[model samples]
Target: MDGSISTSISSSRSSPLRFSHNPPTPRPLLSPTPRLTPASAGRQPSARLRAISPSPSPSPTTPQQRQQEPMEAFGFDALKETFSVDVAAAEARPLNVPLAAPFTIASSRLEAVSNVAVRVELSSGAVGWGEAPVLPSVTAEDQPAALAAVARACELLVAARSAPLGAVLQDVADALPGHAFASARAGVEMAVIDAVANSIRIPLWRLFGGASNTVTTDITIPIVTPNEAAQLAAKYRGQGFQTLKLKVGKNLNSDIEVLKAIRLVHPDCSFILDANEGYTANQAIEVLDRLNEMGVTPVLFEQPVHRDDWEGLREVSIAAMEKYRVAVAADESCRGLLDAQKIIHGNLAHVINIKLAKLGVLGGLEVIDAARKAGIALMIGGMVETRIAMGFAGHLAAGLGCFSFIDLDTPLLLSEDPVYGGYEGILRENPAHLQFPFVNVLLYSYILQL
Candidate 1:
């Protein structure tokens, strides 16, 4: 896909894809690919892109910068104005789920993640569960603020439950604009989507369009000491994980040491180096240049510079590709469709990380479709969330059938599974044949099926 590269399979196995019946787990492979996943397929290039209207345009510097461009309407605003979800009642509670271990990134070291769990009761008494992982660094929403936002969205959901589902979700968006309590909006959207799917007796992936039944995912290793990273890498590899995400971006030397350690232990594993917006332009260049010197070529280089440093982002991306032929993906710099617009228009990255928390389910679909049409590689990721939210994200990613990378490892990282009922099993497992005796057949099928 242009120079925006992502590894993918041609076609899936001929076996009939079943839904909601858990089968015996399949054999794991060194490659984290499903039997028949057409990952990152169905791209539609040459679709005239509707560029976003990013706020506060920069002062003009050249003739091209001063020229006006056509803006494409993404229908998100219309969807918000027509929301309809009959919510009989809605409830929210503070959730402080302790991680099994501390997850360290460049910005913060966290022993526990605080979130808000929501239960939305539909008029038919079908309750859908959702959780919002609140992080100021990621969603600009703290626990208390996200809880309040969820509370407000519940009120709006109750008021407009009779509207269409999209309209009902749109109403929530209208009530909270400009990324206000984004995680909260995301949680509400997911719960409502799950509730609706359960009511209709279908999997969440089918609710979106039934593109695929399973998704393959990679495990993450947070920034840590070389020994710890190498140990974790080998441990994950032994557990059948093929792809590993190395959280880097502090000092160049330490990062190199950690990577070298992992490589020395498990040289055959696939690796993605995520800098988490911790390095400067020059620093990022030096580190990558050094990586090249050390003979390490990661599958992808993610967010090497600060989020707002768009110029530096492009420079690093270009430098990485030109010097080492490595692909670069954007994470922190891409908040929503608008940021995506700026990135694509400016040629900032090879891949864009799409998190459902930032772009609610509907918007996520639209953005992914747009990115695919634009020929940009796509990655579906999640915050450190439980199985509830990330489960839905995994189904959506699989349903889209065009994601290049899958990073739904948050639940694996969580110390406890506070919520369930979404897709949960090994990457090699075909959950469609799995039996669920506890949940209502319809409820379990809808919630658990792909």
Candidate 2:
């Protein structure tokens, strides 16, 4: 969790988690299953990626100057020593997938997932995949914009000749900076990093931190009617989903009713209320008060107010923790490292939701490092995406083993799986648990479950 994060490349394996009888269709892979051998008993962990030393340039005197300064590249000397990556080719394309049902939330409604897919091929013939997920009102870019931005970024990546991996990544970040092009930036980063991991013959999880190979997630129930909520809750309970994240904040009365019906159906399940910036400070507190009256307490309340309402966020956070002993999470309010610094210094919320599409991988890592030092909890969520993006996130979450709450379940809501190559036995039988298979064999594709 500190700045000096080292990598663990363990070969010892455990039996795969038992999944349902029905599994997704398996996609072909370019390489065969990877072989592994147990490390020596006394072997020591090696450092892979680490924070780079500060530059010799003069420090900025003003806050605006500091904000405008580029983030220093994380030293990847370990990667360079092991192997060099030459960006042979890259491409981006429209990735549109049908959702199982309409995904309705506080701010937006969607019948399908419109995203951008990115492919990065190394000169060594190793390939990586990424997805830029677009959620209207949440993400800065729509489908067309994401596609165009990613295409431009891919062209830049291809134009670079034998650049260091870190420099190549920094160039992508420079091209797609801030929320305006964060989704595109994240997609390109994912592809680049995944390709690096493949080139070195290791899984992304191992390349990240190797904390754990699996991550448990909570299923989501979007804003819906009381009856529909109850049915979905019951169905998820049967599916062995222990936690349910309810999307609220559109209508107070309707939200309360839906919660009541869901509670009636699945009384034992824990709840996470994600308002998605739908309520005011007072309304957020009132919802908690009513839930307490019904003898129901959510484990967490997410983004109860708008992103810019810092004061309201702090007020709701304090009230939620003091009165109900429930944690408030800042999702929309935290779009960058500056916002993370504000929340940390001002004590705005108990948890910060880390979405790579919003902050990109490097930006997310910087926030995580800062939050860990400040003793704040973390949550990893994502826009509705296919396995390409969600799978990349799952590797980081599992490898870090630091997130308090995991909400990477959007792939389950998709009607069909597009990019797929993973353990076929791993399926939605236990949809809450995500099992990351060996990525070394998956040079061309990757899959992370719901």
Candidate 3:
């Protein structure tokens, strides 16, 4: 026997008994069974017996207590304890501002930005601002329609009183669904989320992500005569803009002429051709061929075909990359999550441009996450907007730190900036560097949930 027997006392309510390893086989003589005395029957078990017995059930926990466990585990206990959203009032009105020049693109022309401004006030007296930029050719709603939709949505927001950030944003999205009211939804979402950030004393950049405090942006050169394009290129080049996004596809021949003119004045600068869904597959290919013959290869080709022409977009995208090493981006083609998924899975385009006015803030974030997971490139652009909308885009782009192309320079074209406290004036002082004024002390990913 390698092992020795060990004995332990039982804590059960019984008399003490001897424990033996083995007993003799023959014990024929019978012994009378032992009897319990009156004193022993009345005696209680020892303290050792009580120590090993089962414990009583604990008091039931409250629902609030149960909920707090996960919150504490996720490090959101402090945020929840200190901050909450209680919407006090919401308002929307017309926001019109003049442009420095006629901002002409392939699809439309704008001498001024006719948009709607949104203001969301918290019960804590914190206020946030946003803009619904209206481009008649692109967005579904015009200025009047956007204003009305925003006003209606604002009423819904004010009625919400106090609610979860995600729930409020969802209500706004349901009230204003799809591209028909996307701009309005975005404007309302931006204001509410901004107010939430302010209530928590966090900057929008830090709330999004602390990737970087600044983002470099590319300026747009609208469609114009060759001489005018050259002049604008020179002016922007002097202003230290290294990349120029040229609006093309209105006239293929005129487009080529403008490219040549800009090249003559700023040869070292890189180029991004934004056709704005203005070309057939063949015309887009022909333009690339012309540029190749001129020994010029653009860095990116944006929206070369119509939004619905998936096959055409894929063809241009493939040819641009396979032949001339250019990337074709889907601006109009990618308007929502379905469009983003189609582009990602079918390999329709090399990049997807995100405009908050086209896709609401929530929608934009959903697409950003989806595209990042699929390893697709991102570009952030905007319509002709003031600093309100453009500034919000700048913060998002800077915070995410994932966009390959940044075109939030529309505010630069505005003749007058209506909204203050944004990235507008900073870009002019130093076009290459943009720094937001908000100081970020706490960095967390909880804002992504909102």
Candidate 3, poorest ten consecutive residues by summed lDDT = 34-43
What TM-score would candidate 2 get against the native? 0.82
- Flag regions of model 2 displaced more than 4 Å: 1-77, 80-83, 423-432, 440-442, 446-450
lDDT of 2 by residue, 98-188 (tens): 8888999999999988898888898888888888889868789998999889989888877778877777888898999998898989999
Candidate 3 to native Cα RMSD, angstroms = 28.4
Off by over 4 Å in 3: 1-83, 424-431, 439-450
My TM-score estimates for the predictions, one after another, are 0.79, 0.82, 0.79
Top candidate by TM-score:
2
Per-residue lDDT tens digits for candidate 3, residues 1-450, read 122211111112222111111211211111121111001000111122111111111112343653453221211223334455688898887887778789888889889778888888889877788788899788999998998999998888877767767777778999999988988888898887777766655666556753444566777899999999999898877666778889998999999999999999989788888999999999999999999999988877899999999999989888877787777789998889999999988988877899999999989988988888887777889988865687688777766677777777776676554442343122222234444444321111111101
Give residue 145's error in model 3 in angstroms: 0.8
**Model 1 per-residue lDDT tens digits across residues 326-376:** 777898888888998888888888888988777766667777777877778
Tell how far residue 243 is off in model 3, in angstroms: 0.3
For each of the candidates, the C-alpha root-mean-square deviation to the true structure, in angstroms, is: 11.2, 11.7, 28.4
Regarding lDDT, does 1 or 3 come out ahead?
3
Candidate 1: residue 219 Cα off by (Å): 0.9
Alpha-carbon lDDT, every model: 0.65, 0.73, 0.70
Give residue 208's error in model 3 in angstroms. 0.5
